[model samples]
Target: MRVMELVRFGGADTAFATRELPQPVPGPGQVLVRVMATSVNPLDLQTRRGDYRDQVALPAVIGNDVSGVVVETGRGADDFQPGDEVWYLAPVFAGLGTYAEFHVVDQALVARKPARLSHVEAAGLALVGVTVWEALVERAGVRAGERVLVHGGAGGVGSAAIQIARALGAEVVTTARARDHGFVTGLGAGTAIDFSAGDYAPQVRAMGGVDVVLDTVGGDTLTRSPEILADRGRVVSIVDISEPQNLLAAWGVNATYHFVFVSPGRAKLEALGRLVDRGELRPVIGAVLPLADIAQAHTLLEGGSPTEGRGRPRGKIAIAVHPLDQPPHGTGSSGREE
Candidate 1:
């Protein structure tokens, strides 16, 4: 099997290397997947740069999301079988990842691919879907009719969060640059504010404030979200959470600040699959690159939304691990299985 791995922690191009390794067999309670597609996330970039090295073991195969076909099943793994199409979050530090042609993961963490989406979309959704699910549904306890503001609406997690919040009946508001307003609106955000051109806090207040704020961009954005919360409303971030006490005190709001790490879990993955199958949610794939061009993908992600001279991307960036013709079963037109 061929895998792209981070042999060292540093620059994207310098750390990632392609290596040939023996195909792995599934262990008990595990499934071996022939990876069809994988997507890049900020977490992948952070891992490559050693930002989480103290928490994640070194020499890691770093990708987090994968859409693939079950090639083999280990003993006690009765929930899945060979030839079943599946998608999952590969365990970050403790397990091998989806950056390779094949990956082995716990059967409990694998879910049947949504029958409506393609491999690329399925792969793109796993990590972001799980993160958003955990933050809004679990941590923030967002309810229908409640107002939710999602920061970084055009990014991977932001895009997924908007769709999930809308499906759950929440009035979704998101912040993106002016150019991405249409893209975020198309994903069902009721209000798309230009973060660069306007003040989100005041804009949110004019619309009855917000019950939940999902912050994908940290720094000042995360710091200011609490100010717009409607009393006991919550603020959850997948990135920086360094000033919880100060932010809470300054805002005078009952806030629940959270740092999201999308853990691999079977139940959540299955729930996400059901949502996709029902057409209530979809993964927005901004770009797709061949596996060999993963370095370029990382470069793009690291650069954030492209600047004026650089071509900008609209959604998640995916890397095709297998040939396009060999895409996993149940794939759909949107590059997702759902």
Candidate 2:
């Protein structure tokens, strides 16, 4: 099988090397999948930059999102059979990741891919979808009629968060670049504030604040979030905290905090699939590159957004491990651009 390996920890140009490896055999309760597509995330950038060097060995296959077809099943793996379409978030920092033509994961983590989504779409949604589900649905307990604020609304998780919050009957207010206002709004964000224009907290607070805040950008977000949080509001952060923050303001309003490091499970995917099938959720893909262009994908993600001329897409950047056909027409949100 062909694989892209992180040979060293450094810039995208110097870190990756392509190599051929023997296909892995699934263990008991596992399934061997022929990978069709995968996608990059902020975690991929951190991993490439050696942020998690202590957890990963050199020459590692590092990626989590996967959408593929079952090629083989191990003993006792009765949930799926050969040729079943599936998607999953591979265990973080476990064994080899999904950056290869073949991957093996336990059946418990795999879910049937939403029939309405293409392989590229399913691959793009896997990690971000599951993360947003955990943060908004499970952790924050977002409900109908509530106002939810999402930071980095044009990015992968933020984009998903916006739609999911709306689907749950919450009104969405999101932060994005002025140029991306249309994009985020198309994803169901009722209000879009440009964070760079000035301090957005005051602007958001003027709208009576929000019941929930989903933070995808780390720096100073924790310290400033309370300023715009409604009484008893929940703040769920998926970004890693690199610095200490004062939560004194949170004490006054009984603010609840949740820091999510997502773990994979079939149930979460099924929940997302239900939303997708109901036409409430759709994957937003910004670009689709072949597997050999993994290095370029990393570079594009590390760069800024499309408006900044870095050419970063508004949504997920999918990598095709195998040749993929065009997505079914009208399977994407209006916010999506290729």
Candidate 3:
């Protein structure tokens, strides 16, 4: 099996190594998938940089999202048969990741891939969709008619959060740059505020304040959320903040805060699958690269180098682990040597 791994946490360029390794066998209640495609999450870069060094060992295969076809099933794993197309978010810190040609995952974490989507599309949506669904629906229980503000609306999680919020019957507002106003609006945001322009709190407050604020972009956004939150409002943050922020304002309104670290489950993926199949949700793919070119995927996601023509990717960076008859989106790593 060909696996792209983090040889050590020395950052993207110095960290990645491609090597042939033995294929894993499925255990009870597990299924062996011949991975078709996987997507890059911001966490991938973090893991490669040793942010979670305690969880990920050296030479780790550290991807969390995948869309693949079942090749075999373990004892008691009767839910999916051979040849079933599936998509899932691999368990975080689980050691085995989705960065290889084959993955042995617990069957309970897998769901039938949305029929209308290609493997690349499903791969792009798995982790980000689950994160948004968990944050807005499961954790916060976002209700219909609520006004919700999504930070970083053009990002992978924020884009999905906007549509999920809209589908839940909430009016949605999002923060993006001037270039993404139309893009975010097209994804179901009622209003797209340019965060780069100035403080977005006043603009959101002008619309009577939000009942829910979903923060995909961290930093001062968390600190300023209280400015736009209605009394007793709920705030869900997916990004971790290390700096100090005054939450004293939250005390005034009895504000409740929820920090989300996504948990992988079949039910969440199944719900997203239904939404995708129904055309109420769509995956946003920024780029698609071959499995070997993993470093470039990280660069594009970080938007680290202007000279490399790398800017923040539009959505998730999809990696094609296996060749497809039809090319995937964004020309990530296709047509290149491994």
Candidate 4:
């Protein structure tokens, strides 16, 4: 099996190396998958940079999302068989990652890939889908007729959050740059505010504030989120910032807060798959690269959205682990979680 290892922590160019490794067999309650596609996320960046040094050992495989076919199953892995299409979040900081040609994951964490999606699309959606599911549905419980504001609406999680919030029957309001207004709106954002252009808080307030604020960008966004939140509104942040944010405003309204770190599980993926199969949700693929070009994938994921007359990406950036017949079809993020 061919694997990309994060051998050193620093620049993307020097951080990873490809190596041939012995194929792994599934353990009890696990399945061995022939990885077809994988996608990059901020988690990959932080892991590569050694920010997660306590969790990830040096010279490790680091990718977190995978869409693949099951090759074989270990003992008690009766949920799937050879040839079954599957998608999962490969446990980060552990030895197994989705960057390799082959991966082994627990059956409990595996879900059938949505029949409506391609391998690349499934790979792109796995981690981010799970993250949004956790934040919006599991944590915040966003409901119909509620207004939800999604920050970073053009990025992987933000794009997915917009669609998922809409599917959950919430009216979606999203923050994106001027370049991505149409893109986020197409994903079902009724209102797209350019956070850089002016005061977005007033605009959101005029529309009855928000029942939920999903923060994909931290810093001041988290600090200021309570301003746009309806009384008792929930704020969920995936981004982990060390700087202390004052919640005095939130206290006045009795606002609830959640910090989500998405964990691998089959139940959440199945819920996402149900939406995908129903055509209520779709993966946004922003970019695609071959497995051999993973270093370039990292670079592209970190780079700012193309400016000027250049196009802004729609979804997640993916890497074809098998054969890449499709280029980065504008379906495709950085270190923390967004």
Model 2 lDDT at residue 140: 99
TM-score of each: 0.91, 0.94, 0.95, 0.93
Top-down lDDT ranking: 2, 3, 4, 1
* Cα lDDT of model 4 by residue, 16-94, tens digit: 8988888899999999988889999988887777788888777788898989888889999999999798999877566
Give RMSD (Å) of candidate 4 vs. truth: 5.6
Model 3 has a clash total of 4
After superposing candidate 2 on the true structure, give the runs of residues whose Cα lies further than 4 Å from its correct spot: 304-310, 325-338
Best by lDDT: 2
Model 2: weakest 10-residue lDDT segment is 328-337
lDDT of 3 by residue, 1-338 (tens): 88898898865778899988888899999999988899989888888888888888787898989898888899999999997889999999896899998899999999998888988999999999999999999888999999999999999998899989998999999999999999999999999999899988888888899999998878877777788888889999998778988888888877889999999999999999888877889999988999989988887887745886668877678999887753322224232221
Residues 311-331 of candidate 1 have per-residue lDDT tens digits of: 546679998888665443233
**By TM-score, highest first, what's the ranking?**
3, 2, 4, 1
lDDT of 4 at 153: 95
